[model samples]
Target: EETHPVIIAGFGHFGNTVGRFLRANGVNATYLDIDSDRVALLRRMGFKVYYGDASRHDLLRAAGAAHAKLLVIAIDNVEKRLEMIETAKKHFPNLHLYVRSRNRFDAYELLNAGMLHVYRESLDTSLRMGVDVLKMLGHDAYHATRMSKMFLKYDEKNLKKLAAIEDREAYILEARTRMEELERILQEDTNNRLMLQVDAAWDDASLIKEATQQATAQTE
Candidate 1:
């Protein structure tokens, strides 16, 4: 019964990534997965993984949950994720739980349940791709990055704030209002940038010359 500091409840993509990185850094973790085939394959490859239903307290205990300081819930199923959270909270109250949420709605539920580190699986990556899209569309890289950061900050704050509102009508109104406000701010930013570009001293020829010189310097 060797105990590990970290216990991962899922062995899918997200959980596997964490486990691989942790192992690369010499950190051993006990991994529990419902997929018996994956468990057998990983065990054959010299990885320590146990096949069990992680939502069960007995399975968690068998996976060294009592001694584990960190429990990562990377299960994809919403019901199972909630069940795992409830079970962990009840049995391993001392463990620091990190949960993977499918969206803002899932995050709201986790936040309301008192889990502090709930990660939205797609939000950050999607925002990063959006920032790159803005850059490719001729926006300044720094500006695009700043705008993306601001958007993420506001969205996260709103997710937490809106979670407390119980009335569905009020929630919809607040969400709609926030969306309009964000659109207005972005529109203003776009107009201001266009105005600045229009008023710049350098015309197309000078801008082209500057770019040509930079490219020539890089080549030389």
Candidate 2:
């Protein structure tokens, strides 16, 4: 039986990236996308993508959702995204779901719907940009990166905590308090010099050598 353990539902920006990363790691996944134009384009480019609405149970089943181990939901439409989740739950209860959210509010909706693996499309990239800005402003790279990680951790936790609060005013107050707390934590960690050492392991020479050797191996 031909079985693809991972089934990706969408082939747009985020879905393509997830598929590329998995393929690079030697993992094969079946892709289903709603856009016929995209499916035709990708097929000509050597990708095996099926054209179908992933929210339909019959289409999902035909795409191997029943036997797939992981169902990746990267559909950009909010309603279709939720419908896909519902369809997957109803038709393939055993499949693990990984979702991509448009923003924090979308994340809250997904979280409340019991999805544990939801990634915000812009959050990580924006945080990395902020880290770069900090480095450009004369902060240590390691320190800036560490601060971004800290904020990421805290913000994720805060999102989950804030999701349950019903009162908007109370939630705003709590969020402000948490923001202040995060700043204080970052300040303390920085003052204590909690940073990785800039040693040989972190040196550009070592990194360049490793990349060169990898490229050489691939060409051979």
Candidate 3:
């Protein structure tokens, strides 16, 4: 049998999908889940899965954990997720470990466990949905992403700068003034109403339509 490379621990919904996608490509994947029902279902579905706890060294080693190219940890239970990550990091250091975290705390423990590539799975999806809402309301996708990233960076920078200030009210006032100054510097040289109109028409659809029509008219 040609051996599968990925060993996904915690074959819950998230992990199950990952295995299924890999299997569709003829890439065999081994699974580890504490849930007996899930394991049995996978086995019946013709997947090579282990009904075993991933934290145990023997269990992982038996599942070819050392030779496995990648380890996907998608256990919903935060405690179990950390345990799996710890075991993988300590014993299977050669394996690249990816973890799904439920919250900020879970991410912290994973990062502390020496795993950098940890994902708060639902966060990105939620953010994408929010961006889609903004897009439908006439925001450009590229600009929306840029503005979000820039605002986050700017907030963090200001927070650090204000960390040492003695008066909170004074800090707030100064920050507001600084923001106004920066906005004025960055904005187009036009009245606020005109700028708003420009922004409203700045998304991909409108921009493309305008560019194409203008080009066609020029050619004519």
Best by TM-score: 2
Q: Rank the models by TM-score, top first.
A: 2, 1, 3
**Which sections of candidate 3 miss by over 4 Å?**
140-220
Candidate 2: what lDDT? Answer: 0.90
Q: Candidates ranked by lDDT, best first?
A: 2, 1, 3
Q: Can you give the lDDT of residue 202 in candidate 1?
A: 55
Tens-digit lDDT string for candidate 2 (54-157) = 99999888988878899999989999999999999988998999999999888989999999998999999999999999988999998799899999999999
TM-score per candidate, chains pooled: 0.79, 0.86, 0.63
Better of 1 and 2 by TM-score: 2
Clashes of each: 0, 0, 0
Query: Largest lDDT belongs to which candidate?
Result: 2
Q: Can you write out model 1's per-residue Cα lDDT over 1-220, one digit (the tens) per residue?
A: 8999999988888899889999999999999999999999889978888898999999999888888899999988889988999999999998999999898888889999999988899998999999999888997898788788878887877788888988899999998988888767777887887787776745776888999999999999
In candidate 3, which residue pairs get closer than 3 Å at backbone N, Cα or C atoms, i.e. clash? none
Model 3 deviation from native, Cα RMSD in Å: 8.6
lDDT of model 3 at position 209: 95
